[model samples]
Target: MTSPHDAWLAEAVDAARECAHDESPASLEGAATRLRIHASLERRRGSSKRRLTVISAIVASMFGSTAFAYFTGWRPFAPATEPARPTAAPAIEHEAPPRARTGPGPSVPVEPPPLAPAAPPGEPAPPVLAAPPAAAPPRATVGPPARRPRVLPEPAVRAAAPLSPATTPAPGPDAELAAYQQAHDAHFKGGDPAAALAAWDRYLAQYPSGELAPEARYDRALVLVKLARWSEARAALAPFASAPVGAYRQREAARILAAIRDR
Candidate 1:
């Protein structure tokens, strides 16, 4: 069965494969050299398949991730965006501020100069007539309350006799008088009991025996009674009840003291 031609060809092919650098050798049955070449080719093909499998697997993973995101509504973190602001409304064109009145301003109230003290009666009365108050500039408002006429009704006889020190009221319009007045005003006009309390305390501290001290003490007692500080009220009323410090309102103080005692 072994032919010489086939044997010779196989021998040539083996020689070429061993002697040549190129791998394109002729195929032959029962060729020992072909075994090594085939084994090398098989290894290259296996490596290529493995590389393709890895690349396919990577691609499939990326696709799967994309699909999951699309289905699940997952998105990359995006900072919250601010809603667009509405366009500003056109600026209202306000009339420019009224220019300062160019012409002479409204007539300044002309208060007539203060009149001297009225003379005593009987002697020819000096003219008290003030020119009809110059019609008070007809303000676009009610005319100011009638002002005291600058001219006086003729003064009673000569200037009033100078008041003696004893009969004259405590020469005031000073701080002490002002403080006492503020306290009194607080008691009646401010309508705040606590303010009245503070005012009286301040006034008394500065003026324990001032001319208005008795009146101040009496008013303070009344305020204390109103505030339900009956203990202090009773104490304050004690001097008045007992007539100490030239106390006044003894009848009222005594009755109030009796009421307190009964209570």
Candidate 2:
């Protein structure tokens, strides 16, 4: 009986021997070529793996750098943040109380002055008198009854001739002449123009053909002007335009009429 361990070792050695014996030159050569190809493939696989590892490391580094930059607030093109503004302090509040003044104030009392004294009653104040000058001498007078005149004998005188009828005083005042004179006095001498005009009208009616007719008409026109009756004034002046130049108021009427026409 063989021991168990020796038997297993022997079997492993037999298998090794058998495998060597079955190998041939051609097979070895084929095996060497296959091994070389396998080795080249394995080298390629190693190179590929190394390259993948390098790429993975680069990608991981990029991701880590980006994450770190995001968390750290590092940005190449981003705008900078403004500093925070300081907050204003709250305002303090206060309450005001009414004030009370001390001590008494001054007083103002106004009083008027007394009136002047009154004069004494009755007993009229003595007249303020000027001093008298010396008295004048008395004038002398003579009595008129001392001298007498010699008397002459009286002679009877023939009666005075009877007064002629022509020489007798005129019977009455000339009515027409008196009226014209009154009108003239009222219109020219007196300042009352309305009364003057009324008197002139009466004179004209009583003595239309009197010598003073033209003069009366002219004065009437003047009064009419004062009365502001321009039309009637012009009518009064119309007759004088054809009157003789020597007429009393012809020239005056013409002048007044021309003035009226111009107006």
Candidate 3:
């Protein structure tokens, strides 16, 4: 049995025994406990690092989101802007006051010249007389005592006899007739109807029953017709119409009256 393989196995067994004899159980247990403690400490340190990274990521995400929202017009925490203050106006230049106007100065007083002395009284004045003229011769004067005899007025010539009632002249039919004819001619032939009518009316008022009265009335009616006085024309014709022997113009009056009534 003292072969080479056998010797090597024995040497290995002897070294193991020597190593087992040198190490203590207490030391081995102590080393194992230290290794467990180191492993646990390393695991705790790794976990703490991972938790810190996760927290940092969450904080960065929130900050990015807030910045994005702020750029998109969200201003939840923005302070209010103040109104701008107005600029003050510049001061204006002032003009000096105008001088007061002064009129002319006071005038100096002047004294008047002295008056002359008064004259003394009591000097006597000279007297004056007028001369008389020579006389002329007297002539014979015709005085009232040398008067001539006078004849008396012939018994105060008795006032011409007072006109008696019988002597008083009366308006005659001939005068009325002449006046009516004159008025008629004036109205018809002379072209003076107003004067003619006046004269006719006077004649009618003075001698209503004269021979020419019918002619006067007829002419007056014609004058009225010419004047466009229908009513007065009708009135003027009335007297002629009632007469038994109507005047020459009565027939004409009747014809005109008929024409007016028809109208």
Q: Count the backbone clashes (under 3 Å) in each candidate.
A: 8, 0, 0
Candidate with best lDDT = 1
lDDT of 3 at 74: 70
Clashing pairs in 2: none
Which of candidates 1 and 2 is the stronger one according to TM-score?
1
Question: If ranked by lDDT, best first, what sequence of candidates would result?
Answer: 1, 2, 3
Model 3: per-residue Cα lDDT over 126-204, one tens digit each = 3333333333334334334555689776766677877898786786767766777778777878876777778778888
lDDT of each: 0.80, 0.76, 0.69
User: Between the candidate structures 1 and 3, which one is better when assessed by TM-score?
Assistant: 3
Candidate 2, residues 124-231, lDDT tens digits: the string is 665454545544444334334566687787898989999998795542348777888898899889999899999999988876887777778788989998887889
Model 2 ranges off by over 4 Å: 1-173, 244-248
What global local distance difference test value does model 2 have? 0.76
Cα displacement (Å) at residue 251, model 2: 2.5
Q: How does candidate 1 score on lDDT? A: 0.80
CA RMSD (A), model 3 = 32.2
